[model samples]
Target: MKDLIKDVHENGVKSDYKEPKLYDVVPKEEIAEFEEVMREIIADIVSEASDVACWVYVQKYVKHKPLDDMLQEWSEASQFILAMDTWFERLMAD
Candidate 1:
């Protein structure tokens, strides 16, 4: 995705429309602070999701879950984490 953006900027695609100059909504000086706050928010969400996953795992164990069920639970938790991380990466990229 980054590569595509870079290519569009550098190589001039055949489109007749001109791209508007995108301005920073946040002031340049405050960008670092803004990003730090965003990171904190993302971190909190990720932490909560992790805690929930752990809780679910404990519950399953207490119930004596079968191996297939346990594996499914793990896969779900992993996918959720991966999705959150990917979303964060894209957000930061923009």
Candidate 2:
């Protein structure tokens, strides 16, 4: 029983880390939208167009808007993109 609860919690956390709150409403759709937006987010990051893009997305989508914490915010978006790439690779492999 304990192991079952742990497994359930672990699975819950993984979904949260990837697509966030919207994942619950429609996990597949939310993940798809995230992958699409992440592409543009990364292009902006690479070109150094505006670090602000990361904040804009968070402020709009995420509920609690953190005040301009670039390091954490960038890391979150960076990791999110990395996660997407890993999933995509696995998805393609199958």
Candidate 3:
């Protein structure tokens, strides 16, 4: 490429800017923080839905699911809601 030639001809230097250090990443705690944020988001959505709303979801996903499945889904949904509320409270307080 002409750009490469220009750099060599003009500056007489060689360095690859495209190659980067692999250490420029956050630690595991940062990933945990993101996962917590996602859990909180799911919780808020579950709260807004209010009640075993997974039947519709199952129906949408696979078209017909049992009562037990729906109930379990609702339970998980409630857990997410609680977690989301907690996250929001903490975030807003901060």
Candidate 4:
């Protein structure tokens, strides 16, 4: 997972990545529409992740929650964010 993140960061996201064969069969307009919808979905996932992370941080530091419980929540949130990021990167890539 770390390697995938590093590769994405180093190579950068390829929003335009698409197969030539797909272009031959599918209309460009349809492809554009699909991509737009996908971008919107990814944006929603990122927004939700941001909200979860913020909530977890508040629970841990502001509310003075127990260390073990807070740490577990934090870890889960962090993993979720990372997974979303990786999925987005892969979606944008070939």
TM-scores of the models, in the order given: 0.42, 0.25, 0.25, 0.45
User: Which 10 successive residues of model 3 have the least lDDT summed?
Assistant: 51-60
How well is each residue in 1-94 modelled by candidate 1, as lDDT tens digits? Answer: 6776787789975546666532346777787888899899999988888775555545444675654564566665656544544554466579
Best by lDDT: 4
> Over the stretch 9-37, how does candidate 3's per-residue lDDT look in tens digits?
89997867565433345465577787788
Report the C-alpha lDDT of model 4 over 1-94, residue by residue, as the tens digit.
6876687789985445566685687787799887788899999988888886566556645786654565575675666645544554466576
Model 3 misplacement above 4 A = 1-29, 51-94
* Candidate 2 lDDT over residue span 1-94, tens digit each: 6776687787763333355466666577578888788898899776653444444444534744443443355665665544444454466579
lDDT of 4: 0.66
Stronger candidate by lDDT (1 vs 2)? 1
Q: Name the candidate, 1 or 2, with the larger TM-score value.
A: 1
Candidate of highest TM-score: 4
Candidate 2 has its poorest 10 consecutive residues by lDDT at 49-58
Assess each prediction's global lDDT (C-alpha) against the native: 0.63, 0.56, 0.58, 0.66
How close to the true structure is residue 42 of candidate 2, measured as C-alpha lDDT?
Answer: 90
Q: Which stretches in model 1 have alpha-carbon errors above 4 Å?
A: 1-23, 64-94
TM-score of 3: 0.25
Candidate 2: count the clashes.
0
